[model samples]
Target: MERIRRLLQRKTLYEPLEGGSESPDGEPIPHSKQQPFSWLDYSVFLLLGVAMLWAWNMFLAAGPYFQRRFESDDRLLRNFQSAELSVSTVGNLGSMILLTKLQARASYPKRIVASLVLNIVVFTLLAVSTRLFLGVTASVYFAFLMLVVFSASLATGLCQNGVFAFVSGFGREEYTQGIMTGQGVAGVLPCIAQIVSVLSVPEKKSEQGAPLESSTSAFAYFLTASVVSTVTLAAFAFLLSRHSPRQRIKRSLDSEDSENDPERFVRKSVPLVRLLKKLFWLAGAVFLTFAVTMMFPVFTQQIQSVRDPHSAPRLFQPASFIPFAFLLWNIGDLIGRVSPAIPGLTLTSKPRLLFILSISRVIFIPMYLLCNLRGKGATISSDVFYLLVVQLLFGLSNGYIGSNCMMGFVEWVDEDEREAAGGFMSLCLVAGLTVGSFLSFFAAGSS
Candidate 1:
């Protein structure tokens, strides 16, 4: 009973050690001071987030290329390609949930290193699978492809949880912001790579009589992804090395056993159920935000052209709109993620207002559905300018609102709870991605 009382007392008196403080043992406790924000911190967090999600974005960005690989008439293949993220998101969701429940001694840096190695292996295998199965039956090809995607998704889930958890340990919200910004870059970079790949391919006739297979470009992209994974692996190792004082402090703090720390006792005293309840609103807001935004990529690829393919500018041609829309969305998302840094613009202090704004995004669904994409005649969907505007809005809102919710959730929790909170937020975000991906099937059906 005395132990319980002490724990409760600690909980009640708990405050982050931003400055020096005395522990119950009458010893001075050093504050876990965060290093002043520097370009190195920004680069690490941003690149880490980007590296974690880059493969997933490549899967989505390569949809047009995948469509061209299969029989031209196979709408099912197109749908599957479009929904690949949802499929992997299932794996992602599962991994995060398991991480939340499991207690292991593995540190975030180790987890990240393992996840990066796994990603490199998975991406390399994915490239090989595409090449090896190119001549095989479609059934065999897609089966192998899906397996690879699931593996990548599972790796992504682990990496994302680790990255977020790792960054939260810094006790700075900007680290989280940098991760979100990196994710935006993840989405944009693949599209840019795809564009460059498409533009670089020499116009040549293939023996199969269709233009040269897009698989060539895809192979190069995956290979590039693998190389990037290696670079990230190196960067993380360097960052976590003892030479860096900031990381040394974090490693020491993170390595401390929970039983040895009074702060851990206070964190443990809070009921898990209460913490979850506190996080429910932010999670739901993220779910709805992503659920609506995901449908954009699903329908964008199928839209009928507003003008003749030959008449359009090279960049805005019918063949390019899908990637173009994706690129625009990502660029807007990057902008939105950064926008919160501006004074007077952050919604972190206003959860209810943020919730309302998130919910209001549903209006975009009906508006997008009404567009004349894939319709018999030119309509609002065919208007490149209009579609770009809507996509920009969609991406912007998703980034701004999602970043605010995540940052706020972390800030609301005790430092010890921040890692779990990040994992919980990831759970919600992946759930949203999964739900949205499933809904895209219905959207595809309607189209």
Candidate 2:
């Protein structure tokens, strides 16, 4: 045990001169000791990232299913859109508030656990609410549903901030990448599950009462999502229990000297104003990245392929295009997130280039709008393949550029500042989501 403890303790290799910290070559070296992370460290970071956002992803992916539940009543359908927007807005608000106000004061692991617990409770309630309130009045049902949506969003915000802070402690670029990759997977898995659930239901002989069928499907989908949330909560708990370099370093440093506190070594409370000024551009990039990307589910689903009157009905119907587009976007996002692992793909060194690419993503909005969906004007093309390709590229750019921006921001600050940086960036991300979700309402109106 003593040998292990000694090995885990970080050792200072060089002492700085009294007058200056610069070396002979005039390069200023960091005074903090560094601990190298192993493969296990990498794996844990990646899994935590995945688990952190899985519930949020599942919630977003279930949009179609939830929307379908009110197909019978046009009034309820219109209200559903408002409710959807509220959920996103409230959720983002919750996350932004938590990260901005409480991140520095709260313990990261405890916050993460709290968020996961909230998710389990909220999801379970969603599942139970669907079953119990299926026959209730529309007003009552929507009210209950909105409460669940708000709760889920709050939990998501808390979890995302906690997860980002937790992983940032490792101070490894790959750990950031792992978390981003997990986020992409979170989007993908839920989409796949939705597709499977949709396919499993038998085709009805008559098209009458489609709304009833949709409601039933919605129940099953929410139930599945709740179960997944439960599993994710369990996995997160297990991962949190394991030892990592960050924990080991803190433990050793705490044992060695109370005056040289490890927690204090890596975290300093900087003025929010100064922090915002330093991170403005990076935060804007993250905001724009998510804003443009959020438009996808909001607008893309409204686009339908120009129907072929002469063709027979297919097994994977054109209606599946919405989910398929979602799937492609997520897969492309995963590919993009993984791309930085390749030495040649890393562009964090070039902030200008990355920022330009991120801003250019606005082009996708117009491209998607002009596609032959439910828009007001002439469409450039009604080709389903064209839309799919566009979605793939959109997802690719979103993941790649978003990851680069996030990782670059982390690297820009001192090791002690990384956790706060993560929180700030998370706040930006939520801001973007909220703004984008609001914009989605306008996009919906235009259609």
Candidate 3:
């Protein structure tokens, strides 16, 4: 009915929404003056999205740094990413399960705020730890690092569930996509930073025993992440205090949803068990989607350019190749995430197709294996172009398939069940990350 009134009002007052008409739920139609959300709202949520995922994405971008820190222990160096992600996913999964079971629409804002503070404190610790731990053994510092990873995962669980529930309850497709857009930004920035950190290592020193990313650079990078969280937290505090139009309206509507039809909402929600059952397919689809995605980086990080490192330019050397490839993959991801906002590009009413595509991403495993892995010989040699193109398409498909799965859940269940569905889906997504993180050990090992 709300969607209908918006359409009727649009036809009478304005010419028509671009893209002929709104495509479907989760579709990003062009905005006009009449829409409730403004540029300010979009900016806030975009930062929210970035701050929500920044910690882990920072870890992802700083894989080489972690590798360097653990270089003394070959086994630890090989498996630090897997272990860090393992702890993170476990922490995320546990917290999300608890948060989902303890549902209250009013708590969403609180969760986001709390999560932001947690992220800031944890990131600061991470930044400072890089330069400190002077006398500590590498293993002990690695333990501290994993603790940070675990704490960040807890924050991720809270923020992801809160942000999605807020967007879904607010019933705005564009704002959710704004978060998606910020996710693209989140993915890109860390990759760029990784490239910079790797490059900043002086050529002379890099050729020496210290081939790792600079500790100073890593310190600056992690500290910058902490500052980002501080800014996002301040922005959110302002949003709540200012009581913008969007917040005002959302509060009233949320109240109605909670207070007006308490019995109906309870009846609609049933139990968490039953609610999750209804979303088995949705959960499974997201599970498989991210399961495949999480496997990519661990293996791909080992891939080297086929160009002869001795003669090839610095940019093409093994050290630089890793970060540059990550940058390209993330750049492709940004493009793919934004593609759904465009009219013709969005995938709608295509769950089966999306699931099939999700499963099909497994093919990338062999594709990566075929590339010239550093220690492992390559079946596909002298073909850096092949690896680059594969990374691009890999990222594009991951973004497209994952976005459509998230958006189409509204169509998957009853109206009152939408909120519960959001939490369950968030849980499922993190569960996928956990499974994939563990599986990466075997995947990368095989490579």
**Predicted structure with the largest lDDT when compared to the true one:** 3
Identify the runs in model 2 with alpha carbons over 4 angstroms from their true place: 1-34, 60-73, 203-220, 244-256, 259-267, 307-318, 375-385
Q: 1-447 in candidate 1: lDDT tens per residue?
A: 999999977654233333121222322223344345656767877888888889888776565556556554465554566546666878888887787654233245556777889989988986786677567666566677688888888788878777776666566667678888888888888878766665666544334333343676678778878888899888776665522454345446666553476553232333447667887777778878888777887677765456665776655554455677778888889888888877678888677778788899877766666565764554464465445667788889999998888777865677556666776777778888888888888887887
lDDT-superior candidate, 2 or 3? 3
lDDT of 3: 0.71
Q: Can you list the residue pairs that collide in candidate 1?
A: none
Which digits, one per residue and each the tens of the lDDT, describe model 3 over residues 195-275?
A: 666676665332224356667777877888889889998887675554444434544556666466444222233366776
What is the TM-score of candidate 1?
Answer: 0.83
> Estimated TM-score per prediction?
0.83, 0.82, 0.84
What Cα-based lDDT does every candidate model obtain?
0.69, 0.66, 0.71
Give the poorly placed runs of model 1, Cα more than 4 Å off.
1-31, 72-79, 103-106, 130-134, 200-212, 242-272, 378-385
> Which of 1 and 2 is the better model by TM-score?
1
TM for candidate 3 is 0.84
Ordering by TM-score: 3, 1, 2
Candidate 2 global TM-score: 0.82
Off by over 4 Å in 3: 1-35, 72-75, 204-210, 241-270, 273-280, 375-377, 382-384
lDDT of model 2 at position 356: 80
